[model samples]
Target: MGKSYYYVEVESLAGETICLQLPNDLQGAMRAYRQAHPITWENLL
Candidate 1:
């Protein structure tokens, strides 16, 4: 079976919290997430 990912909603200063999926390797997802949402570093947490 393929790997499964878990997600959780996190609050950010931007306003609406987001549901993030945790992948086995975060590098690619991190890149894509930043590109899709241009939030500050702090907002990323």
Candidate 2:
């Protein structure tokens, strides 16, 4: 079985929740998520 690293939950502007399981650490997950959806950053902060 694979190790569980980090779980990231991102909600979109359209009111959809997206879930992702990241193999990297928290920092890496955040970076990847931000890169994938820069617009969501504003809502997160």
Candidate 3:
């Protein structure tokens, strides 16, 4: 069986929207997004 992939849409500080292919579920995708971006917990809300 093949591993499932997830699409994570993220925005950069430059205002460019990019789609990332993550090899994980929603929780994993969120973790990847937080690692790739410089956003804090406070910034999320």
TM-score of each: 0.37, 0.38, 0.40
- Candidate 1 versus the native: TM-score? 0.37
- Over the stretch 1-45, how does candidate 2's per-residue lDDT look in tens digits? 643355668799999999877555565756666678888853653
- The models' CA-based lDDT, in order, is 0.66, 0.66, 0.62
Clashes of 3: 0
Lowest summed lDDT window (length 10), candidate 3: 36-45
> Model 3 RMSD to the real structure?
8.9
lDDT per residue as tens, model 1, 1-45: 643344668789978899988665875676666668866633775
lDDT of 3: 0.62
Better of 1 and 2 by TM-score: 2
Query: What TM-score would candidate 2 get against the native?
Result: 0.38
What order do you get sorting by TM-score, best first?
3, 2, 1
Model 1 Cα displacement at 14 (Å)? 2.9
